[model samples]
Target: MKTSLILGTALALIASAGMAEQITVMSWGGTYSQSQVEAYQKPFTTETGITVVSVDSDNPAIPIKAQVEAGNVTVDVVDIEYADAIRLCDEGLLEEIDPAILPRAPDGTPATDDFLPQGLSDCAVGSIVFSTVYAYDRTRFPDSPPRTIADFFDTGKFPGKRGLKKAPKALLEMALMGDGVPADQVYDLLSTAEGVDRAFAKLDTIKKDVVWWETGAQAPQLLADGEVVLSTAYNGRIFNAAVSEGRPFDMVWDGQVYEYNLFAIPKGAPNKDAALEYIAFATGTQRLADQAKWISYGPARKSSAPLVGLYQDGKTEMAPNMPTNPDNMKNALASSYDFWVDHESELTERFNAWLSAS
Candidate 1:
């Protein structure tokens, strides 16, 4: 009888293990994903026993839309830009996320109040505040480094290949700023056809010297490998390359275009329950701050700031390196989600045509 009981318990344990929950999360690859793995995924798995499968994508939004529309949803969670999240949600491709699922701050502040105003949405929860900024090899510009956005486009003076993202989003805005447009007026100007033409005209100045990158990791690599003297990159990638890998890369924040990166669950996700659990855990007060230690992106939750300290190296301070730092924000531009939502298709189409021309 005792032997029969033991066999039955063993069978139950095996079945439970077979049914264990796991969720796949997709995000931009490189150090950014590594930060999430250490600060969010590891702890989440430890606390809940739900396995997390981290996947890398040049852009998560593309595959998310494709998978949902095809009725073969694979990723349960995705880290997407603010504009993409709104666009996807409006298309009914994402699951509606309730803010109540988020945990309150340690001081008893509601999570809704603690997160930055831009962090929460109908279907998304913000994760980090990162910037699309340009960086240069310190060795390349040791004597007279580029200081402003205009310098990035002044190839005749700087005289080297430039690294730029193939997309129009931040590129257009930076081009306009480099042409002397103020950060506040960038979107207003881009809203017009003449403004669009002007931005492209500025880009025309360095068209022959541009080397394009499609992925975040490639931007830093391009600089390290001497493929380009200067590159527009996610600020955190450049930070990781310098501090972690000892690459002599330095960022130029003058025209930095900053945006919130958010987490969302796709509609019809295979493990929606686990996905929700993971997002709530990952965006909590502590987890958001912990992420800053691994990368320079600012935490999206206000309550998380005090918890943030030195980098994973245990020596480098994380604050001044953040894109949100007042020093960095002197000339920084907040990415306008409304503008992108209204103009992305038109601008992207125009950009493609221009890239293919001549």
Candidate 2:
């Protein structure tokens, strides 16, 4: 009888361990997401004994919509763009966060406070802050490099072939800025008809010189191949291309449009509890600081700034682009996800029309 009781207790413990819930997290697959999982998610599973199932989605919304519509919710947490986060929340497709169960800053303040004011929202939280900036091939432009959006438009001053995103978000902002609108007045200008036309008119000045990039990878490639002397690109992709390929390229952060990649729990998630736990772990200050070292993309948590001490090789100048630097953080123009959400379709149509005319 004693032997039987001991065996039963062992089986109970095993069963309980087996029953520990697993969570499914969906994100864009690339070095950034992979490094994040390796550095944070894998360790989280080891410490908590909860399994994490990472999945890839080209368009995060597609899978989410399919699952939710079918009433068979599988994804627990999703890493998406801020615009999509706002759309999903409006559609009632995401679970409201319970911050009480999540991690707090070391000061015991809520972690939400560590993010920029625009970055905080009721149903989603900022995870990564990425920049859309100008990259130039140092070899091609040995004498001059584009420093700002105004320079990007001035073909005669910094004359070189140029590349821009096909998307309207960054281009529209750049257009407004180049048309003599101040950075602070960009959104306001775009909100008016004459201002919108002025932006497109300025873009027309460089239409022939501009090559529109469809993907993040294309931008850096154009720079490396000398197809375009300068291109607007994601800082991470451009940095990687320059470092890995020995390309003579550098990024100009001036007048850059910064957008936040967000993480949110999907509605009716099978493992909502585990999903929140995973978000808290991934967004912790230490983990974010570590991530900045791996990828140049900036951390959303303000506290992660100080944790990024001098780089291993003492590259101080390179440190500003390291994501944790206050100056870079300040220069980044926080993208208005709400505006994008409201005007996506119309903006897309206008962009397509402008591209066709170009």
Candidate 3:
């Protein structure tokens, strides 16, 4: 009788521990994302007693697809690139989010009203907004900074060397914009055969002067060392470099190409309830605002904007990346994920061929 009672007690304890919630979250590997996890996800787990399995995903879809195919899906939530989120949603790999579970907006506005129009969908929620802009070495060009996309490509005018992203999306848009196409007409122009050729022809003019960046992280290093007078780079990379290295670098957000990172729940996840809680906690107004202080990326929640006063005061020029800033948010161009997803394979093949030729 005593042995049976002890055994029963042990089994009961095991069952209780097993009932504890565990959520697996996958996100891209970067200093900014890491800081977000620490600031938001860690506190959430501490408060709720849930276990978070944070995974760094260079390509989140591969592992997620494999798990689903193997009939052993474990990923609960995923933070993916804006374009990748669209692709996954289109393929029915993500679960629709219920906004009712979300925390109230910081400013007492409706939660749905706080988000940008593109941000309010059911499939995913916007977490951070990053910019692809011109980062120039202030020491090299002390008199004036390259103010626009046109200045970036004009080597003779801004003169010295320039760097551009190796990827085609932003480069294509910048080329069209430089060719005098209005911002509103950029996508329409690229959708045409002559417009596409015209954009490439414009790029060809600066091909020799352009040092193509392989990754977002690489741009800061190149700029700090003065490899090129001006380069297109992620805002976070430039901000971090300036703060850490004290390198004389400045970013110009004029004609910036802004992209969002989204948090989505993968379909067939093992812990949907815990994942939802995690999302609600991470995207909560306070946590979102906290994240902005440590990283250059801006929070999606409008209410979080006022909470970021300290960080904003320190980096006034970086306000353009902030979602609450009307002028910045208004002028920012949202890259078309649909177009990229539709033509990714062909576009990638063409991009690779062109890169190899150059």
Candidate number with greatest lDDT? 1
Candidate 2, 1-358: lDDT as tens digits: 9999999999998986575468888987665667578767888899888888889876577799788878998888888888888788888888887556556777776876777554556678777788788888877667666667787788898777889988888888877776667778888778777777887889899889988887677898888778888789888787767665568888877678888887898889877777888888888877776666556777778777667543323553345775335666544566777677677788789878988872
Deviation (Å) of 303 in candidate 3? 2.3
Instruction: Report every candidate's CA lDDT.
Output: 0.93, 0.76, 0.76
Q: Which ten residues in a row have the lowest lDDT in candidate 2?
A: 309-318
The TM-score values for the models, in the order shown, are 0.94, 0.86, 0.86
Off by over 4 Å in 1: 1-17
The top-ranked prediction according to TM-score is: 1
**For model 2, what is the error of residue 184's alpha carbon versus the real structure, in angstroms, after optimal superposition?**
0.5
As a TM-score, model 3 comes out at 0.86
Off by over 4 Å in 2: 1-21, 310-319, 322-326, 329-332
User: Which residue pairs in model 1 clash with each other?
Assistant: none
Model 2 TM-score on a 0 to 1 scale: 0.86
Query: Global lDDT for candidate 1?
Result: 0.93
| Per-residue lDDT of candidate 3, residues 143-226 (tens digit) | 766777777777787877778888887778778787777777888878777887887888888888878787667788787667
Error of 1 at 283 (Å): 0.5
lDDT of 2 at 43: 86
Q: Which regions of candidate 3 are displaced past 4 Å?
A: 1-22, 59-62, 70-74, 106-108, 159-161, 312-324, 327-331
